[model samples]
Target: MSQSPPARKPIIEFRGVSKSFGTQRILDGLDLKVHYGEALVIVGPSGTGKSTILRLMCGLLEPDSGEVLLGGLPLQAEQLQRKPIQVGMVFQQAALFDSLTVEENVGFLLYEHSKLPRTKIGELVREKLEMVGLDPVLARQMPAELSGGQRKRVSFARAIMEDPTVPDDETQLLLYDEPTAGLDPIASTVIENLIRSLKQRGSCDSYVVITHQETTIRSTADRILLIYQGKVRWEGQAPEIDACQDPYVRQFFDGKIDGPIQ
Candidate 1:
């Protein structure tokens, strides 16, 4: 007897997603699939539409022609409900409220979303900060007073505070936008190590990290997807990146000046 077709399981799927600004296209027919518990790193030149991907995932931006499906569900205009479907985001700038204290910032989501008392949220916030290797005493400090790395780490703590799970699958995804963009070598390494640890938290939680640093790229990524000229030219394991045959991937990986990319 003939067997039935196998079922398809996907935590997130981008189908022919394309985006444009004014007249210029940023993403063209970009199709990507992110499974649960997979760490996918997207690397490319400055204007290669890397950030667009994250925006699309969060419904902050929509594809001009295609669609973004979360948990097999398409995100429409009204369907863009800010419901916490187990997703968290960490922006490069730390994007914390300078006016708010660290504890308040970390508890922002919990305070607003949960019916829990402020004291409970505050306790949870402090716990989250400590989990990121920061002292709970830093909670009363302001963002401006912290160093760049500390600020980023604090923001990461905030991102996960709403999560209630670090490396776990309570959330389907964690979107990182240039998580290591403007830091010194040591700070960058710290962030990279945090990314690795996040993966260990759960077997069902996956990540999409947008970065340009080679070390950041090499350390956190299990798979690499190269976006060139608004298109994904190639993809594979991080260790296999140097051996990739695509000129765009090769030029970027080897830090070359002259290639088909330029």
Candidate 2:
């Protein structure tokens, strides 16, 4: 008989991770993994450390205890600077610099870090803009001039921008924190489709999305993780969510007022 193929290591892993802020605890002994090419969605009640998890994964906030590994190595600020697998984040509010034009914002990383000429950076910026369904001409417009959906698309373009010269500096993982929070249903659907299209286009190897919108969860997740009281309380595929009997899963997804979640 042929031997089973070796298990693939996770692109991102949290081992017994815990975090606290002043007097309140956020994460407690939480363990999680994001495999390559996976679209993982995390859903939970507000203020339950969902955003905190995204911050930890991107090295903005270190865990109070336990380890966060990226590409199977411990996540460190210095390592993030040179890590072969890059990680990018799209904040809930589409945190574009208000002072910069769309082109400037999308190409900020290259402008600040690389020695590439301005014309080359401009070409890459327009390419990414078009990829995200934005007209290249919009590159000259400021962030304040764009609508909510446009702003989100600009942020997406920014997140996926990579330097072609640095072959090792590819963005392999993207963390989205409540990407569709304030959009209307139609706009939300657009963002949702973009999320799927980005992955299918091989822009990133994997992504972790933190969202509460039922439609978003259904549209993007390959697997679902429900966090309650700082730990994973349930896990299942998108289709399994409706049939799951776990109190936290039912309470959160069904919008019920009474359950273990309270």
Which candidate tops TM-score? 2
> Candidate 2, residues 62-86: lDDT per residue as tens digits?
9999999887889994374676788
**Model 1: residues with Cα > 4 Å off, grouped in runs:** 1-8, 77-84, 163-169
Off by over 4 Å in 2: 1-5, 77-81, 168-171
- Say which candidate scores most in lDDT: 2
Instruction: Please provide TM-scores, in order, for all candidate models, with all chains considered together.
Output: 0.90, 0.96
lDDT of 2 at 182: 95
Count of clashing pairs, candidate 1: 4
Q: Which lDDT value does model 2 have at 193?
A: 96
lDDT of each: 0.82, 0.93
